[model samples]
Target: MEIVGSRRKNSSFSSADDAAVVSTIPLYRSAPELEVRLDDFELYAIHRLRVLKGISDGLSRGKKPNEMENLTKELWKVNMRNSEASEVANKDIISHYVLRLVYCREEELRKWFLSMETTLFRYRFQLETTDAQRALLKEFDLPYKAVSNAEYESVKEKLNQVVRSIGQPLSSADTIYYKVPFEQVPDLVATRRVFIFKGYAYVAMNQVVSLLMTQYRSHLSKALVLTNRKWTSMILEQEKDRLTPIVEALSTSYLGPDYSQPREYGEISLKDIDQVAKSSFPLCMRHLFEKLREDHHLKHGGRMQLGLFLKGVGLKLDDALAFWKAEFSRKVGAERFDKEYAYGIRHNYGKEGKRTDYTPYSCQKIISSTPGVGDHHGCPYRHFSEENLRAALDKMGVGNRAVQDVMDKVRNRHYQLACTLTFEAIHGASCDAGINHPNQYYNDSKNILESRVRATRMVDTLMYAEV
Candidate 1:
């Protein structure tokens, strides 16, 4: 890769200074032949890296900076307190190497790997002090560099010229700038968000992370597509033993909020299902509940989605079985219900085949999954079109303003944020937190409503006492 910012001029600097500059930038040197085998701890490092990447991705995607920063600091402090100095120090470097090995053969894998790595880099960069930042720049051999006062002064005229040409106001003196290649920051150029002169884009410091991430994502996307065409699976399979685990780790690893605890609406009986669904269930689940009630039956996908949600909301196995049987028997009689639908309901509760304790589907799973014509399984925000979703929201008593806001979020591809907004609209309160799981949305809705009820009751009691 070509280094874009702060062009290294050998003629201007002394030999010693040049050597110092070169030494600061680490090279991606190959590991020794004998050091090929990875230990169990090394394997665990991949998992740790994944966790860190997940944290970083979440921070980038709408999380409050202060909250994420504190969380990141706490994570490092915990690691240091455990005396895992080696793991703490080597994780950034070693994880990349491990991912490189795993993602080298496929375009899809490379794109995912690069996206996560870039997010990790941004998170680490944000956390570092000025000196540590310099150390990281050296450690990673990053192409971009901060502009010095002298360099800034020299480039000021050209920067102002470009700013004027683009019809944007001159940047404030406090606005720190970096010189990056124009090609690498096409998004900035396209959006007219950066000052470009010659071949470089003089990007503000605040825009650096976004610019770099976009470049990384675009570069990796293309690289992966090209690699897919040229690289064969036979070559990839040669190192499959080592690569397979990393791939598996990436797929199976989840370090987000746990939805396993039965915290929302506790001990829901078969008869109380309708009441709970109406008052506390998220829009997605509410839609499913209404459809099931209306039809007295649901498709398999809907059953799975709604079944796990009911279990999550503290519905016992016996109640769940009774609930399903009662609903389905209305259409198919008790015999058919027991023979066909009963087995699936029991399986969902871990009573039948495989006996796996299937948890509720998360927001990510729901949004990403595409529901068929008859299925009411997936996220309504993602699966439904703008017009259809708005109509659905309208029927749920959502105002035009709230529906418009949700439409804006959906247009921008912020599906989860749209769901949060929907929750706010339905509950008539600010959620004040991220909604990652359907169960979380349900729990938060119940909690918010309960709090409001308590507050109102307290006011009424005070009024009675005064009277």
Candidate 2:
């Protein structure tokens, strides 16, 4: 299927009124015609998705807002920046529109895209200078009542108290407080971060992003609903045949490295499997490993999940057969294992049936999988019960404070962030390389452990040489 915005011959490109330009606020109000190439359509959408995912990952890593700002700046520089200023601006605007089309299909997809886009806008808004922010408000026609000097002085003490309690130390003379209706800034009101006087919220200059964000979210949410309706009802039959599949697939696309290639790392021995799992595996794989060991058999889903991950981590097919045979032999003898279970293991290695070499599941795939009773597959952060997840964290020796933080991420449905938190708690260091795929986590953890070992060996060699 062709992309949505491909230009036809003799058609006007972008109008002067709809020129591609990046502004302080990227409120995409109008759809502009573009001369986008077929290849550029998927490329632009992937790049923008990475930026949005970077924001989600930053928050998942427990980064403060200032830290998240730095993270996104670097991501933009790497992913969205172009040599020309206008080109960069075009990418930003065009990519945003492309993703809107991709994500406007379902309610869940729309909600996720809306939340990430709003957070992105809020981060950019927070970085603008005060004058720039005011200009943006004026440009967007967001009217706010600036408190008079006399009215500000009347409530100066109360404003100071509220702002101070919220850790914003702005003196009365220095700050420009806006008197927005309490309803407009309900988040601040509910959190008791702003001083309320008569039906108005006294929001400090730095806090105006909250009001703007609320408005932006409301507008974008309604726009997505309308877009979905139009997408289904108004598109021409020819356009639907060309555009539907490409747009739908963009939402669940995985842009990470391929895991189906031949193993570059050396083969892992069956004897070392337990040690390797403990040291390098993500919690999902580790949990599955333990279950397989305990029960001496795993259901089909668990076998596929853990089995593919093992293959990705350099477990050769021979060792894999031995490993599964040993476990299955405990319950149903080696004969039964070879008769019933051995074919599936060989199939995963591309030696039987259709012989299709399947890639390991990414975090998105695992998170979306629905595991029924007796299944040990899927992301533990997303699938495990809270009590079970907390116990798992405790077993891994994650301290109480970090456990609470992980739990908070889980409660907010930030499953990947919870996994990142658990990684930090165990390693006692930040997971600088965010976890997007199960094999990525495994590779990262193994590299870290290997580095520590090499460092320790170097220190030992120096001490022995001196002796």
Candidate 3:
């Protein structure tokens, strides 16, 4: 299948767009908070993605006599590993890395085997349903609005439009459409994020995308449902001598199959744009980037890292766009804006990919500070201790009683409100849930409290914005 947006290409590394790119954003580079130390979580996945071959392939190869014994042991270990990944007993920790595995490939067969590892997070899609467009489908046994289309093409075009409009202004009520595979019907599981529905299969947002799919599935029943799964029996056959599909571009700046646009930094290559040369940005942004790479070990190889980090730092998109230009030594405009900046904005604003858009602490971070040394960039609701997270909340202008209540809930693993209040303080919005949600991650440590120091900084932004 052809990748989306590969036809038209333009970049502004020489003229980076701040509204979209992280390298141009300020305070994003230095003394930043919320460094996602995905190393440990990342390290564990390398062996699985790189070394393991599908059981079918391993079977057909007929392991050399000497290697057969070890292969058997390894196969047994693979089964155990899959068990640990899927049905690890904790009902809450589903899909720990199923999509990550799927991210290595854009096919379905490899995913079929991976699906067997865990059932709790299992997910599937349907194109044509027997019921009305508004009928409800069972999701984790919860009522989620669903639609189906027997005709594929009608829906695929619709979904294509949705992804194409990346980085544009968004509304809560925009409608969408798409076409997907007929095989997806039995494939629906909780772990899958993006899927084909009718014509367009996706997993952008629960409510938003579902609405779009419902509206257009009836229109485009001729398109094919595309499932971006990592491994499949068919794909495994072609794996010999080919690079295993691993998502190279986890961010826009990195070298990935998704983003290969060359980027410029301060009149030089992005790889060459180091702290020594361009010191024009807010010290916080620059310092933060260096620290992440140096101290905390967060890699900013992707352009998204810096823009994403700055957004996390509370810089508005307008200010962010401007900061990047001044730091650059070249000129940029619409073409640059379309491909690079737009891609970053989509990731930053909760519009695309796993929605890493929440401003970390836009008042919602339950941390003492955003995130810094000694503190891993973990989910604040699940990371912080009750006592410390409470103190950080109090510092963020939360009331004394509210702090106490919030702290009590956080200690009890009530992450929604802890996440909500932090969100409310900064962004000033809310939802039905409050300090109450399941936490597959449980921690009790100073590390949680240490991260809250950045929470205090978020409160400062709320104070300024409200004033």
Candidate 4:
């Protein structure tokens, strides 16, 4: 394989700096051979997964370019620093190859991994200097050649015209264009970003980044498929005992905060539950809350879903009993509420039956659930019919435009993204962290509302002091 050590005079890394360049930016064309401890293997895979999840979440929340850049920088510092440390570089390579193995088992997982990893690669590529980019592309052995002075002299006007059409600055005398096959860059062609001449795309210096992205995506995608085919045979029987469990766990891992643990907060008051539900609950929880209020009872599924979410957001056992009792007693009476419903509520808090202290359901779990007739437990964005979803958005006071945007995501089967849009519309602000769990939505909404209340109180105090 052509590695980073081989450099031309124009390459970003000189002989002295090749080691640093090789360690920092990865093409992921080949798997790295390194000795990784079991602990480091698990930790590295989780760290990389966290970064990929961060990228996916940021995109779902409609983060702007600069905001995403900032997020990437922050995540990189914490999870993927581009340091000179050999361990850091080794971890980066091993972690990436490990995820390829983890996600390669399923077509859906492969597609998701490809999309997120490509976006990540593009982000890192764009951060590089032009010379570094050229060096990397050369190492990859891409066939695109730079347009010669004679060729540029003939087509400079046409290239300048295309540049002007796209509203980019005119190409300078020093600017270089690459003659790439038009078939390779359909994105630029379809978008009219590059000037097409005959059958070749005269990709501008800046536009070469897109070409690199396309090449890297194709390379990584094929690598993943090949990895999938080889996975089972590649692991020896002895190694399988050690590695198989880790692979299985990583494949199904939910790496978000542990909402199952008790949080530090005052117990939720029964009187404030209704207002809090309206202001802070995710649509799934909100639907369950409203249905329970209207009917004065919830079926087992709805109770489990909402009960655990309430517990996650800091509802104590006594308060949870009183809250459910007030609603259930309206129909079943206090006697029936204690006999049937109260024990189940206590079970969710680790007080009854097997006493498993259940955590709130994530968007993935909720989306995967099949809500039967008369059940309002599943994700609204996933389960609600188009008309029902639209009406729910209208009830939340979301504007028609935002509602349509939410519908678009739901149509694409992006249920969590749709929930994120609803959160943004209701709060009139972007959800920087995105909505993965009902409790996360509630906590984020509560914080936003509390901050607004504090701001309003400060304004009121200042006005009264002037009087």
Candidate 5:
């Protein structure tokens, strides 16, 4: 893999080094459980963890469910801590959260920031590049090929296209710029009426996720990934229900096109889906049944069959219940919702769901898994033991893990160890998708997710008045 960016790689290292295109390859060493970082990985990990810690802290403080939910949703943004700026007010209640973020330094953040440009900018060009070519070039595998200061600034300007793509920042708790599913954000920013981060904008609350943000970003958000094609009903055909927001994120001009992602290859192959599902399905199903039994203290044979089935199909809580409520109402009645939807929601995206129930279905797995849990929604890889995962990986020929070379990547959260291994397991090739599947993602996979979780934790902590 050709890695870009960082001082360690700028220098040289011993011949014995592994995956050592640059001496400082950010990796995770599972054997020793040590983290390796030549540069930005260290800082990225720190920033990401800090954010999650904060969010988690906010949640633990015992706010009402609705308030907690909205608070956590804000975790997606590095909040300016302003209620007015919020897209949705916490009408149910008010809460505050705090958490800690430790890291390498501003240099790493800057370096990581600069490197992300190559990935973001790759799609900005209207070239006739293939999806693979785009993925090869666009995905934000930071610290790209070096250039002179002038060249660097030129690239930086292009990146600013993305930054200004927001055109505004939410009252900066340290200004953060990232491309999201919303298209309308024109260099957007927002902040609490009070606490604002310097060097960042003070955006009105409405601008944060205003119609403009959603409109501009929506097309991108709904853009058919892996290609410039809009993921419209024409393409999705039969699977329209499955095309939730992940597809919506395709058109976001700022972040709509992810260069780092391999072209859509067209609707994630059934074969690939089955390949991954087979290895992960049983484990996930078994876990789901157990959660229902132990946590909710409920029992139903359908728990295994139907629960795992929907999970395999990738129905999220909202989507899943809509599916179930439709199905249940057909059989029982709308009242089933009080027993079903309420339970499912609590079981799906809610804190109650997260607190007790662990496994929930995601989009990709549903599209993939067949035979075992086909079209049902759920994560299959987690419950499978390392032994099973190894067997599966070996059968698929992608379970190889280098000592320090790849280990540091996972340990430091530079890569999604579990998900990468799963992707490789299915395709029988080197999968560098970089988006972390809960059980399978790698590299960039962990960043947004890890950060969100940490941000929520931070908020949770602060709300509890726990520094």
Candidate 6:
């Protein structure tokens, strides 16, 4: 991918014919016809193109009709011209540059940018042809090389053993091996996916994608940190304004895989909220709920966190308002509750103020946010001390073993992983999925329990049939 157009170039004033001319020049036209090789940074930038497109689409969601139409037109033009190698390359380069501007602003955003780009790289690499894969490897300048016939013969037995352990019957001769530093691919090492001899990991060619992605992520992460430090030191107002949409889009982006619509989870009435809070709420929300119940009040941050959660669980607007009013009225009186608190609830429901439909706080948002004194809005795994978190889990009836498991993850700053472990512990089932959002935790807990009931029923039916 090659960067096109000057920074000061005004696309806003470009006529339709001008766009046509711009789109005609292929970005990769300068490359040799039969083969293509991208520099390591260029490869990283190419992967970022897909991520930028996703961010742009997400950011455009709540725009005005005219703005949305223009965005749609731009997207259509990109799609129509994607068949041309130059247009694709130009689009990739431009999007990458835009995201660099957007992501350079904050550490969290930079990490998000790196993760997305790495995922894109993994996906694209998986889809590449063998020759293309070799080209990319050459560009990456990776230390791994194909095992020679003589080297394979020496390592044949051990390699076959590793392959058999993974439940595959691949022969040593048939398998292509790459000798890479074991430290470079810790995931493969931790998962026992590769055979290590001496200092190098004998990774099968098919499994190399994971190793490559890890390397890519590490390299890109460091690159981004350096880029952020350099870019954050400088202030360019016009460039900032130009990249504002990309930044805004990233903030609102729900990178989770499953965002189930409201109705699919079934209607959750205010009456059942207490029960749901006990059984379904994640530890963070559960903590907030308990605090609210005990005090009959919460700070603004806590209210926002719990309120949006209630909204997400399908509580009707009137029910949500009434629920808050009733709870707060216990200590503050009905008039005080109405006067002080009603508008904020209404605003969250999109019936007041900006009337924007607010989304519930995702795991990233909760984990990254800092709660001040008296606020209980942030993630417990992130914000809670080890002893306090352990005590809370003990009080909730989680066994010592499970509590220890969760604490181990928490200590590593894997807050979401800790949350997933908590879900598994409480449900008495392994949920082998990452917890990306609070709502996702709720939904997964519900699904796991429901699936257990289904499995039990199926077993009972089979037994009855045999009898």
Q: Which candidate number maximizes TM-score?
A: 2
Better of 2 and 5 by lDDT: 2
Q: Write the per-residue lDDT of candidate 2 for residues 266-384, one digit (tens) a residue.
A: 67788788898887788899999999999999999999999988988888898889999989999999999999999999999899998978678878668767789989998999899
lDDT on C-alpha atoms for all candidate structures: 0.66, 0.79, 0.34, 0.79, 0.33, 0.67
When 1 and 2 are scored with TM-score, the better candidate is: 2
Q: Pull out the clashing pairs in model 4.
A: none
Task: Output the lDDT of residue 76, model 2.
Answer: 75
Ranking by TM-score: 2, 4, 1, 6, 3, 5
Model 4 residue 434 lDDT score = 75
Runs off by more than 4 Å, candidate 2: 1-22, 106-108, 129-131, 139-153, 167-175, 228-249, 255-257, 262-264, 269-275, 291-307, 316-359, 364-376, 397-421, 424-436, 448-467
Model 1's number of clashes is 1
Residue-by-residue lDDT tens digits, candidate 4, 55-169: 8777766678678877876787799753567677788889999999888877767887898888888777767776577667667676433333566778778888999999999
TM-score of each: 0.70, 0.74, 0.25, 0.70, 0.23, 0.57
Poorest 10 consecutive residues of model 2 by lDDT? 1-10
| Cα distance off (Å), candidate 1, residue 202 | 5.0
Residue-wise lDDT of candidate 6 within 270-382, one digit each (tens)? 77788888888998999999998888999998999888877887877899889888889999999998899999999988889888777788777777677899888899988
TM-score of 3: 0.25
TM-score of 4: 0.70
Name the candidate that leads on lDDT.
4
Clashes of each: 1, 0, 92, 0, 124, 2
Q: After superposing candidate 5 on the true structure, give the runs of residues whose Cα lies further than 4 Å from its correct spot.
A: 1-276, 279-388, 399-416, 428-467
Query: Which digits, one per residue and each the tens of the lDDT, describe model 5 over residues 39-90?
Result: 3223333333333333333322223535544554454344323355441222
Predict model 2's lDDT versus the native. Answer: 0.79
Model 3 CA deviation exceeding 4 Å by range: 1-100, 103-306, 309-376, 412-416, 425-429, 433-467
